[model samples]
Target: MSGGDARQISVRTKDRNSEERSEQLAPPLRRDQSDSITYRSFLRVRAYAVMTKPRVMELLLVTTVPTMILAHGGPPNLPLIVATLMGGAASSGSASAFNMYLDRDMDAQMRRTSGRPLVTGEVAPRSGLLFAWILAVSSTVWFWCLVNYLAAALSVCAILWYVVVYTILLKRRTEQNIVWGGIAGCFPVVIGWASATGTVSWPAVILFLVIFFWTPAHYWPLSVKYGEDYRRVGVPMLGAIHGIEHVAKRVIAYAVATATASLLLIPVAGMSWTYATVAVVGGAWFVGEGLRLQAAARRAEAAARPMRMFVVSNAYLALLFAAVAIDTLVKHRFS
Candidate 1:
């Protein structure tokens, strides 16, 4: 063999090595493709999660576990509590998704709700409705199996009341929408008590009233801030129909009623001193803020920032429920 034949063999060897390197690079490209697919899937799931109205679900769950503890007159079974919360979350999430689906037209008109999954087209309307239905059915089954039939039934009622009674029949037609519509938000207390003791009683009923009365106070100020949004969408929210003075006045009245109703829980539930004190103090603070809102309305102060009451109302309810759990735990430990 000559030098030329040797060089030809060297060139072929280099070509084979290059081919091997190309094959090695292919897996990284495939891995990148896999990663891209996973990220897209994550975004889709996150959009569905948003449709669940997680913030509202968190608040609903906040009221639930404490009621269970108080119902047991102590800390209840941990697993039962966890399972009940999971079912309740699914129920509430389904209701919220249904609301988003039903209200998508109005949601599209309002700046505040314009970014919701349905309104933004992140999830299709049909898909959202199906997701809600699936969750509604599964959550009912979950509660029946994990908690009790009564609790399961209550969960189902909450969904129906919210979707059918509140969203479809009442919202667009009545200024009293939130008044009656808000009842759906009160079911968790009864469900919590029923899950714990397998029945509803005076204590559960009293707590249910507490939340029922608190809803207007909790939600109206936010409505006050977004009155124009409601008006633009033809929603009859209290703030949309009434003047600021009337809305603020209603908030004050409801605040007082909410505080008064909370006190009933003391005698009825045998709630501890800590709960009584927090209820009285938190209720006073809430009512005071409401009074200030009304006074601002009287003064015609455009920049009164009614949203302040909206923020405090959330804190007030959270504090009251926290007091409920702490009081029960304290009594359990000391008594």
Candidate 2:
């Protein structure tokens, strides 16, 4: 480069850096502004994080890890596990962010979601949509490079299924939104299994079915609790469309199916006594909670029973997956 041109470029770079430093060193916000720009930036980042739905991703990771262990017949390579989970998080987060963007209108109307980033104006819609697409593409590439092609494809399908199928097509239109739409949530099992073995096996299918059956049992109670919020937003959640009694009945039916599916994993996967015991006992407790909620619904009682059922269902899945991991490790260690 010519000397004059190089000098101009250097001056521009220095000026940019100097401006950044000045901004960093600037005194607290002016008395009129009340809040610093830096603090507002931090909150914007946090709001973006909230758009990812961390709690749902945590439960997804819980299922993914155990399924990977079962697929490997023990704990898999630490680095591979980490890479797969990172990709999974990115995929799920992208789907959630897109859902937030698409549902922001309804979210604004619902009390439960009124404070969501887009709804609250904490994150711009365009930015949220761009973030979602970026994560979606990056996660697919991440899985293909770090895990396997099959895992990557499944991860992409998961995001597509949740965002396109569920969020766009099903959520607002049907009461069975979560029933079939919940299939996206169950893909992590097959993705984890494929990551470990590079193939989907019967064991993985069984676990997938377990999650599929468990979804209604686990989520319907929360739907019952949030029926009014959903109704207010014109979202057709089961508990919003039908009364709590009908929701409770379906919850009991799905609970029974979930319990049966959990037990079937023992025979199909040859899971050990630890898993068997936990599956049976945990399944029973989960169903009992469902029954309690059903009875309350039948009697036209308050919402407490359904809420209790929701809490127990979380514990139920956690314990069952925990037992899967523990049992796999125990047998692998002893053998």
Candidate 3:
């Protein structure tokens, strides 16, 4: 009786083990299954990243590093550097994603924007907003812990300025949208400056002003070319509302202001003579290009000329900052 019972129990145990092994061989997320847990999770993450505006983050982070180098008077605090970068990235990224969420309807209307991941249904709007919220909260906490309160506060201001004020309010309301909204991009400089000193300074304010003045001209040329799209979408862009020719005049005016501001920044930055030279050459050239674009817009011929002006304006900003950085380093070493 005992032997018979023991044999039956042994067979049952072996069967159970075989079933367990078979289950193990069947992966939780099958490679061939498109609906597998891993694949869906990855797509969700990728879509979220796309919404966060990587290009904007690239430029913003670039600004932070230079500010750090200049602020420390040489080698920066390594931990502060990493923390500041993470905070800046997360804050900017969150704002960008939120913008996608807010502008989903407008994006669907414009041909240029209709193909965005959110508008195209590549990413669900809810998921995009959730991602933005998570990132923004986490980033604020991160900066608060790593940097001082001033830096964290500045980051929050940047997010609010871009998402709420610029994207929601200004973008639809007035052509002067970029004029007031450009403050979003200007925050990184202030945040970077504050990260070093933990307080806003006149130099940082000057940097803010320079970027602010540069923004309208920077944007208007593109707006002029895309005025039709903007009009179709019911966006009150300068070019669309005021007319391209008139907007072109404003573009030149902004460029004139920006060039003047660029020259002014050399002294305000407490920088050397080399920076002064870049300002003189860069500013003059910048103004000349603006005038050319203004005339081109008036002629109503090849719009390509105005487009070139836009490209040159971008080059001017990037190079101007780089020159300032290099010149400061050089002069410091020699002096």
Candidate 4:
């Protein structure tokens, strides 16, 4: 061979060798293996999302924006609304994650909670704990930086109250646990008001009490449906310990209080007819459902359908808040 041809052959050999070595160092992944990895990652993400109890967060957020509108007396700053909502979501998610971690043991025993990430071993307890702390710290900082000091402080307090006071101290201790522990859930409206006004007011207090009274009315029926699950886990939920008739009476009382507190908003915030009609009509419907549950309890019917009241309570709160927002916008547009 000519000298040039031999050199070319040598370089070609070297290039082939280099390519072979690179393949050996990092073998190409099989398609199936790549698919398996992607599926696992998706499941991990879903598990994390479930740990946050997003359904509960949705209910908390339902009260927030309307309170902001009432406190602003109209549509507030768009950026401020977005920031407060994001911060509130993060704070709520952090608290829920912490609760899941702490209650994993109880969760494992309860059918309602058996599928939880920590209980099902979808997320390791230690990793879940770390995730909770990271979210708590990051969300508090997000509030401080993006929202305001009052919002930030309230967010921190909410996390502490939910994780420390509710989950750790109260949940397993008393039937009244939800009554007092529900205070954490009430914070969203107050935080919304604070975010809008930089302080809490009588209207905010009224809304806070509305949520407080509405909570038992909202939760007790679900507890009734799942009372056995709670009893199996040795949790002291009222529905698990008390007679259906007794639980129904309490639900009616709280429903009445919720309706009353909602009406107080009309005078305190000077809400218009739109809000007044919703509060009056929706409140009556809400209390009526409670009474219906009580009647079912009196009959000792096997299918008392307590869940009907639960469903109605959710719709009531959402519609009432929607009325609040709509009323404010109507007033703003005309005035």
Candidate 5:
């Protein structure tokens, strides 16, 4: 072979090697493909969040922080509070995910729940179950290691009560489902108090009972709004089986019970004027909303606005707990 031919071959081989190196250095995906992957990842994360039922978790956490504050007589340890909240949130998420998985069939038939991640096929059933288990185990472990064993045990119990007792056993079986199943929602207050004090106290018990009574009042109005949804799904929520008047009457009884429980906390906790005022005023307003609901039901059942009571119930709880925390903080500051 000639010298030129040898040189040309060497140059071609070097060029080919350099091209391969450049190819290897290039990004695996194009910009559009990377964007697509990122969007999919965001969607997956959102789907998982939806499975956790963030709104319900928000209400649970609302009760938790104030109870912790009241238990500590002020702000609790920041790290402890954060850890407890995180674990509680995870536990709640796990239970809600489990509920979505278990009730996917019913949810598909209900308008209110039709948009859930499970019902909408945003998350696979098996994947959701696995996520639930992961959350349940991880949350329990997180509580055990970061918080205390009492909190951990409570976390586990909350999950089991919500999933097994409420979702599995009661939800499909009776119109009184929420009356019993709502027990799970009240666990946060006790767990919060336990996390702060290491034992449940009278105040905690009273607060728990407050939630116990408040649950039916809070949820029954919502059930009234979604009565048809529950009926279609074969879930015998109170409003589904009972007449609006009957449901409204029950709501009034529970509302009065909730208000009475709130007042009990003032004496039991020795809460100050701030709490006293809020409790009396808030409780009256709450009961009044229930009364309004009942009157509306009596005047024209078709025109009754149960959702008005539902909104009021939420505001009432938030205000009551806020008063609890504020009263503690104010007293602590003055002292």
Candidate 6:
């Protein structure tokens, strides 16, 4: 009754305690693993999406490729082009995300921009800004190391101008904000050209002008379409400040100016008949759109759709530059 009974009872007690502890721990371990997996997966997807930055990054990347082509005359710098595009993508992506953050208030007001992940609360403001900062800093360093000092510095300037000057200072201040802020976007081509040539030249300046003049032509029409929204937000766009009819005339004026500047490139940028033909045809058509916009001012939104030429303008520049680059390359290759 003594020793054997005590030993058997103690063993049973220890075994039961161990079984209880194991049962208690099992669900929690499984739950912990499941939660960890879910959180990690959400983070991973967010990282890839990077707060809806891929769109702006892609456009920035596209903006540089033509400069690379024209720089070497025919695609001599594939690696450099790739690096510059990536760096620019990062830099512009950061700027764009930061812009969304800064303009979150305005963005919330505008139906066009209200659906952003940050505004929609799918992602947090802090997280978006942090992603932007990473892209901006990383792209700056990348451009500095891979491209050149001037290119890196200019890239930084673009971001600073966009964030500080255009977004913070100019946007809410004056109706001419778009005009000045347009400078921020116009400089990317200059930076791209300098990254290749290692110096700013007349050609780069001309490309800059092309974008500069085209900026008003591009944005003013759209502004007319959204004048009411901008007025509600206190953003003094051309259409918001001046009458829509005035905005339309300015769009025409800017289009003509852009076309005239584009023609100068036939000699300066060393473009050929191919480029000239595109300039004439596309430019004439673009100008015609502006005129239509000016005339269609009396009509409603549907009537002016023909004059809303952003997509066409984009294609025009892309193809026009491409043709010039190809022609320049052919000439260089043959020579």
Scored by CA lDDT, what does every candidate get?
Answer: 0.91, 0.90, 0.80, 0.91, 0.92, 0.79
lDDT of 2 at 94: 97
lDDT of 3: 0.80
TM-score of each: 0.89, 0.89, 0.84, 0.89, 0.89, 0.82
Better of 2 and 3 by lDDT: 2
Question: Considering lDDT, where higher is better, how would the candidates rank from best to worst?
Answer: 5, 1, 4, 2, 3, 6
Query: For residues 1-335, could you state the per-residue lDDT of candidate 5 as single tens digits?
Result: 99999999999999999999999998886567536878889988999999999999877777999999999999998999999999999999999999999999989998888999988888999999999999999999999999899989999999999999999999999988899899999999999998999899999999999999999999998898888999898889999888888998999999999999899987789998999999999999999988888898899998888989999999999999999999999998989
Task: Please give, for residues 1-335, the per-residue lDDT of candidate 3 as tens digits.
Answer: 69999999999999999999999987685367567888888876777778878878866765677666666555467888888988999999999999999989888888777878898787888878888999999989998888989998999999999999999889999878999998898999889888988888776777677778888888887787777789988998786677556766787787778777767666666777777787778878788887776676677745636677778878887777776667766756776
In model 5, pairs of residues that clash are: none
Report the C-alpha lDDT of model 1 over 1-335, residue by residue, as the tens digit. 89999999999999999999999977654455436878878878998999999998977778999999999989998999999999999999999999999999889989999998898888999999999999999999999999999999999999999999999999999988888999999999999999999999998998899899899888888888898999999898997778778888899999999999999989887887899999999999999999998888888858566889889899999999999999999999999
Tell me the lDDT of model 1 at 21: 94
Q: Report the lDDT tens digits of candidate 2 across residue range 1-335.
A: 99999999999999999999999999866554327787778887899899999998977778999999999999999999999999999999999999999999989888889999998888899999999999999999999998999999999889989988999999989988999999998999999999999999998998889889899888888887788999898888987888777887888899889899888888888888999999999989988888887777777657446778888988899999999999999999999
Model 4: lowest-lDDT 10 consecutive positions: 27-36
lDDT of 4: 0.91
Q: What's the C-alpha lDDT at position 182 in model 5?
A: 93
RMSD of each: 6.1, 12.5, 9.8, 8.9, 8.6, 8.7
Put down candidate 4 lDDT per residue, 123-152, tens digits, no spaces: 999999998988899889998888789989
Candidate 4 similarity to native, TM-score:
0.89
**TM-score of model number 2:** 0.89
Cα error of candidate 6 at position 199, Å: 1.2
Poorest 10 consecutive residues by lDDT, candidate 1: 26-35
Q: Which 10-residue span in candidate 2 carries the lowest summed lDDT?
A: 28-37
Residue 264 Cα positional deviation in candidate 2, in Å, after optimal superposition: 1.4
Q: List the residue pairs that clash in candidate 3.
A: none
